[model samples]
Target: MAKKKSTRRPRARPEAADAPPESANVAQDFANLHVWQIQAFRDILLVAAIVALVWAGYALRAVTVPLLVALLLAYLFEPLIARLSQHPRVSRPTAILGLLGTVGVVVVLLIALTLPTMVRQTTQLVTDLRDERVLARLVELQEAATSQVDRLLGVFSKDETTPDGPETPVTGESDEESAPDGPIPGEPEAGTTGPPVPNGPAVMTEEQVRDLIDERIARERARVAEAEEGGAWWFTPGTGRVARGGWQAISRMIGAVVGIGLMTFLIPFYFFFFSLWYHDVLEFFGRLIPESKRPRTLELLQKMDFVVAGFVRGRIVISLIMGLMLAIGWMICGVPSALVVGLVVGIFCAVPYLGVVGIPLAVGLLVLEQLGLPEAERMGWLWVVLWPTVVFVIVQLIEGWVLTPLIAGKATNLDPVTVLVAVLAGGSVLGIYGMLLAIPLAACGKILLTEVVLPKVNAWTRGEARDPLPLN
Candidate 1:
């Protein structure tokens, strides 16, 4: 018994326990650290990542913008391709090719039908604006308006006495007679001297205007001929400054053309590849998310996709329809450059309420067209104003009642004030691209606030969530 029951059992071997009980307490101490500390670290990391991403995008805008545009195109067209490919007869590649081919055919047809007329009208419009006849008419209207205003003022004045001195009427003949023969000793001559200077808004005879126009045409032709012959078209016998200006203009035009060409090529190249790999691309990004957070993230992303697709696709279709309506209406009303104006208005229509800007543009062009016409042939002022207004109103009504309800269907749900603010902020920060993206971004922000942020705040308030570490 004495041998079997020693007061202290044999000491446990060192191999049975590597560390003391204090090591377990140390782990418990670390686990007791405030939840806010870990959360703060996460928050800081997230903000840093976002800032880095934004900086990278901005720095690589030249490359990124085209890629973004392509991605958007891919987003727009992918659904159609997917649907088409679901048919047993149509493969995805075939679906893509067919859909794209159809779009290409439609676009080519539209260009073939509309381009020549648009080009001719554009040229004519430019010529009309520069016409001596048009200028003389505008001057006459201005003087007539001045005289009418003066007569009205005279009627209201208490003093009827005329000035003592012989009043020199505002007339071309008087200005010409009083003109100096030579340039002022210290001053420069007129910058452009070829077109005859009609003193005091003088009207020129039809023959003189015709002759001047012919001379201008000949000069432009000569410049073109020189350019074709590999000579400096900017150089003329009498002027040196024009050479530099002309060269600058040509350089700018070339730059613009090159930029446009590059964008045209890159957009299609990116779009074709993006469309082919659309699902794969999405899956790649999806894999980046942690498995635990994926389901919630995917839900949010799906909601965002709905909003963006509804807004973008529906708005584009609505705009196109409205543009066609406008063009047809204006053409029937004999508004000059109707196609061009309608296309411009359509682009403006992408932003809510922004299409209103096109009204003044349409009216101004109508007025200009009327001014260039014979008085007998010109539309009444009432018709000129009313027709465009009617067209705009009708189209807007259809857009509001039909297109919005049927297509967009409250996807954004943003109030007008919110939208206006978003548009303004976006336009100020990123110009047109920002403006285009603003509403969708605002919608996404609203979703995040309501779904992610507000719930967290409420829970925290009720002591159901961790308190964020205070900045102070």
Candidate 2:
């Protein structure tokens, strides 16, 4: 009876006996894990991502452009939509239509104002290029540059030959033989050597210098002509009456115009409906998830929405403010095409860090162009020395101390260095469109990863059975 009681007392439940061993094995495996498999998996994912990105770039160019345009337009007008939504009498569709109409009118007015000037300027530029006088002037410039360079080289070469010494003549046999002997030809007597022949340096004759310059000019002109003749096809216009090349260029231009117009036309339509129904769509889709994970999914979506909305709204505000400031500044400086330059700056400002670098550069170039060739040459050095430095300093100061803080705020939580790198990488991958989308996409990705992924990983590390809720 005592032996039977002891055998029963030593027995343990199967679940209880297996639990600790299972967990211990899991811990041991985690501790002794080889990361090569994980790393390989990551590498495979990276390669797949890259391939997908490249394929999407080529395959979805049309859809992508319009979608991006619509997204941006929607973001810009979201505030208006929200405000209009609160109106007692205005329907959402009506409000959206009103905003779209306003945007369209504004855009149309801008194009009307700009197109005439742009066309005139472009035609004038082409005409100027074809003008024989302009070509001659360009040739003259090349000659002048070449001559100046040659003169600089000659001066340096001559300086190299002149030994560093006091103004003393070396006693050479030629000098000794040619020495004056009682009023020799072209020489005064020792007491009166005609101001000692102005002993600082010997000047080359004007005729000889001119001849050297002419030779250098001729060589430069030949080089320039040769290069021009062999230049890219774009630089050379059609040679015959067969307008194939001309038609091709025109067709390309038209295609670009049409593409932009289509983007502009379609974006508002998509944005309006998309914004109106986005919440419903999201909720509907979210319901498919298991009840256990729905809360986390909703939280992730909320964070993503907040991040995207904040960034987009912030960029629009910043771009508008920058455009206003540029217009005002250009007008104050009496710069030509102030409105156009301001508009350009505003458009570019929609981009992040590139705007910071590009706006001042564009303004400086406009200032230089307005100064004209002769004025630019005469006072160009002053502008080259002063204008860019002043403008860039001012722009950076405004961006750092005022605009960026006011618009983007601490919500982005992104460093300037990070923003710049993202923009550059995006630009390299997808050109201008990529650059435009990069920062916002990066911000969204940051929000998703930090609020969604990290919490799960943390819970897993703690041997938790369930994932933790994402941070708001």
Q: Judging by TM-score against the true structure, name the best candidate.
A: 1
lDDT of 1 by residue, 209-325 (tens): 989988998998887788758866545453577777889999999999998889988987888889999999999999999999999999999999988998999889888888888
Q: Lowest-scoring 10 consecutive residues by lDDT in candidate 1?
A: 192-201
Q: How does model 1 score by TM-score?
A: 0.71
Listed per model in order, the count of residue pairs whose N, CA or C atoms clash below 3 Å is: 0, 0
1-472 per-residue lDDT for model 2 (tens digits) = 5655444465698878767667888888877876754777779889999999978977988887677667666655667787888999997888888887887899899779878976665576567657765655656656766998999999999999888987776679878798755554444556663643343566799789989988998997676677688884344334444477788989999999998788767777688777677557667878899999888778876776676777777777877777667656654554445555665676787887655554455555454444346643544434544543465457657866897778767666778888899899999998997997788788878877788678778878898845455566
**Cα misplacement distance, residue 71 of candidate 1 (Å):** 1.0
- The TM-score obtained by model 2 is 0.63
Question: 204 in model 2: Cα distance from truth in Å?
Answer: 20
